[model samples]
Target: MGHKLRLLWAAYRKIVYVYLLLVLLPACALLYVYFHKASAELERQVAESMLRAVEQVRINVDYRLSIVLEVSDSLILNELLYDNLAEPASGYRFDQVMEQRNLASLIKSLKGHDILGIKLYVPDDKLYAREHVHFFGLSEARAQPWYGDVMARSGAAYWVSTRPQLYGAAGEVQALSLARLIRDPQRFERVIGIMEILVPETNYAPILSGAEFADDAEAMYILDRAGRIVSHSGASRIGERLLPQPQFAEMTSGRSGILRFAHRGEPYLAIYDTLQQNGWKTVSFVPARAISRPDWATSFASPLVLILSFLLLFILAAFLVFAYVTDGMVARLRQITSRLRLRGAETVGERIANRRGVILRLEQSVAHMLTTHEQLVADHYETRMKEREAQLRALQAQINPHFLYNALDTINWMALTRGASDISRMLNTLAQYFRLTLSKGRDLVTVEDELNLARAYLDIQQHRFDNFTFELELDPAVRECRIPKLTVQPLVENAVLHGIQRKEGHTGRLLVHAYASGAGYAIRVRDDGAGMPAEQAERLTSGLQGAPGPAPAGYGLYNVMERLRIYTHGRCRMQLDSAPDVGTTVTIFVDRLPER
Candidate 1:
């Protein structure tokens, strides 16, 4: 009996040793995976936090600039400024002097606001006046780009470049200037000068230089428009350009939202927004390191400490269990452990092969389920999308038909009012145009049909105007291409109604061109009429969602964009490029439809 007990004791030791090693291997593997995953999760959280910080900066800067620009608008519309300018002989031959005086008074009214100084530039007289005229007196304003641009735009507000200049009582040299043309409200003619506001460095510097994430993290300044580093909180390289240039230009052009950049050897995430009021782009950059520091430290320390504690507790429990078990049972367990080791080696390969087979079958089953589910989802979505499209079409139909009917009725009334046979003929043509626009039951029509409809609309408009010429250039290849019905006509109507109708001295030229683009067809309607500003074009493109309200008197650009989005499932695109005197181009891109 003593010999058997001794044999069991030896057997038990072997069993415990093998069992502990087997459990330890898997525990170690699990620990590795847990830590790796934790690190990855920490990185993602950090990146997101950095993004949020930058966005906050963008919001704050844009908000401040918008307020300043609103103030500038009020100054332009102010009766006092107008009254002062109207009295031309009050020792102010140039309106710039009066603007500077009035701007100074306006700045004082906003007592605690961050306005550093006010200045004015008169291009025709080549004169400029700031608050501290003793230092920068009557400079050649024509040579400055700000003055040139203001003259070129006639009456538009713009944020000028940042350059060092002296102003105010202290005569401190600093980055300064915001300029806008002063124009007569009645005729919209330029009234002698451009108003310039000097922005205080303190107002902008604090935005660039605040505690962002932690002690180690810093914020940097880049050109609000181009993302070029104008200043950095750290490092001497302020003017040097950042690499992988952040999409600052695109943001300024109003294309995208978040941007990332590496400035001063530190990675930064940037959030940017365009200021509609002043045309200035504001961006906030925050270091990526700041966001991840807490998470990274916690991820490393907590996991290692948890795994060690768990290992110690598990080892103690395992030893106690082995101690309590009988010696004879321990011998059996040793044999079992030896068999398990052999089985485990084989099981690894077997499990891998079996897992592959199981995974293959699982994947096939999942694929079949997904296919059925996707088809069902697609059908449901397609049905809903179609219903929405139909509702939009119904709404659009109500508007277009009403507009055409009113236009025709007006033409008929005009013919009777004039008692002219020519007017009667014009009314007949106009009626036919309206009839074509109200096509029997078709939403998608041939490009040829659209062109014919547009020509008819133009014919009526030309007759009404007595002096409008239109040219049509159609590519024969695109004649069979299908397009949303009434697309071309509305664009042409916009041109005639908004562009040419209001201008008195010049004859308007309307050009319609159709051409082939990559994998699609493009149709452009162009007009040499009073073109819209960039801001107006941006609003028209972006403001398509929600309720359709009263449109501007002449152009229904938004309506056209909405109709295109609905019909083409966003495949079709419309682009409008315009300048005040350079005229406007409205281009439409549509996929070439398969032959019916």
Candidate 2:
């Protein structure tokens, strides 16, 4: 037996060592390399894609600005506009009508676009074609920052950061200003007036909102030279200053390129391009984690752990097999030897002389050993059953006695002051509640009995608190379903004590509802009162059972959950939903068993 056990142990150790070296080690190394390479490749792809998105946004903004510039060119060439401004006072009624018609026609051409309304600001006089023109004092037009900038530029177009509004026939609308100095036709250097285009920011949203580098990326922005957001895809970001990030210093420095930054403990990749027309930067920010592909290194960790656990278990099982086989053989051989020696077979030579007779006797010993093993297994099972039953009984006896005292005390006072009928009714309800709690020493009881237990408890509490009320809605189909006793009463007590009793002036309402759902039954208790915090509700489901309790809320809940899980073998579930000052709902779900 010793030699055979040694051989078996050696074989198992050799196999385990060989498998660890040849299989697990190499597989882990390969997975690590694959994840590293894949992560690098994914970062490269995302960076390149962000650069492309930045360029596309730049083009879209430039295109929108160019449209305004084109409109400026058309106005500069309009002979009626120049003639009307050059001369002021000498015109008839028909000439005035024609000039107004020409100005209206010019405004009509740019309609249905982002141009909210156009105003030609002239400081010369209120007399010269104020038909579509806004006449202002010369000092006033030159005093404004935007208008002064346009005047300083001579004829160059400027995209103003100040969002101005344009009032039209329809209504007033917000717009971004694109202002330019209108030049005299003959003397190109002479600035006559300013032609300002009010373009709505909505025009840029359609193009930029569709341009996304990654799902987690911040929306793209058109930032002005001062780093203020002139336009952006997300409405919330407009008018906000873009933070001067180190990653996109090129944007703030008037250069164009991409850069990476790790800011606020998060990895960021940013790309930017300068728009030549307006000196605005088209910038996009992409979070590094958003674009990273799933890595095999992370995904393979669970499987590797499972495999290691399985390997350890296999080694343990192999050792157990060796120990059991060798030990059992040695013990059996000793027993047979002792019995044979008592029959006067002491030497190996004497035993071998009657080997056929010895073999017949060995068979009888094997049969008796098998019978003994069966009996021991049966005894262990019975012992475990008795232990569980004792635990259940202990849990059942632990229901709050204060509630019983209160009910009896209320009955005694009511009997003396009120009538015999009232005394009888309250006593009957108390009897039913205790009967359901005991359930004749059985743990399982019908759903109807459970609901009645809750009803009795609530009725007794209602007499104590005048502001308290309750409703029960039980499905007829699930009335006969068997669930553990005291399930519904504890939850109802929690509702009454913590939920309704705390509210000062308002009447509190409690609801007990049960229904069939899927292949199971669900019992729900709800209350309108000052509810529990979310974390407390979460703890009731996850951490409550193991916590040391004789606690106010935890007394019955822990026991009920433990016994329910044991009886159902972990098929049932409990959930809690709550918000402060709103309400609380506790739901218990149990799988349906075969009909009794």
- Candidate with the greatest lDDT versus the true structure: 2
What would the TM-score be for candidate 1 when compared with the true structure? 0.45
lDDT of 2 by residue, 89-181 (tens): 343766655655666677667654756667776545434334444333344556667876787787778888746464656454446788877
- RMSD of candidate 1 to true structure, Å: 17.8
**Candidate 2 wrong stretches, greater than 4 Å:** 1-30, 88-101, 128-138, 162-164, 169-172, 186-189, 245-248, 252-256, 293-596
Worst 10 residues of 2 by lDDT: 353-362
Full-model lDDT for every candidate: 0.62, 0.69
Deviation in Å, model 1, residue 245 alpha carbon: 2.5
> Tens-digit lDDT track for model 1 on 1-596?
78965775686767657756876667678767876675455545444443444444544555556556656655665556555443343445456555555645765674347566656543333233333442132255656667666677666667765566666555664554567776644345646555777665456657766625444544545453545454345435444444444445445655335555666777755555444435444444556565455555554555556666667877677656665565367776888789888778665455422111112322333454556456556655655565556555554454345446677788788878888778788878877876777675478888877888888888888877777899888888888888778788878877887777655555789999988888888999999888878887666655544444345722366667666777777777777787787678889887645354
Runs of candidate 1 exceeding 4 Å displacement: 1-22, 43-53, 79-112, 123-139, 183-191, 207-211, 220-222, 229-268, 271-287, 317-596
Each candidate's number of clashing pairs is 0, 0
Alpha-carbon shift of residue 367 in model 2 (angstroms): 73
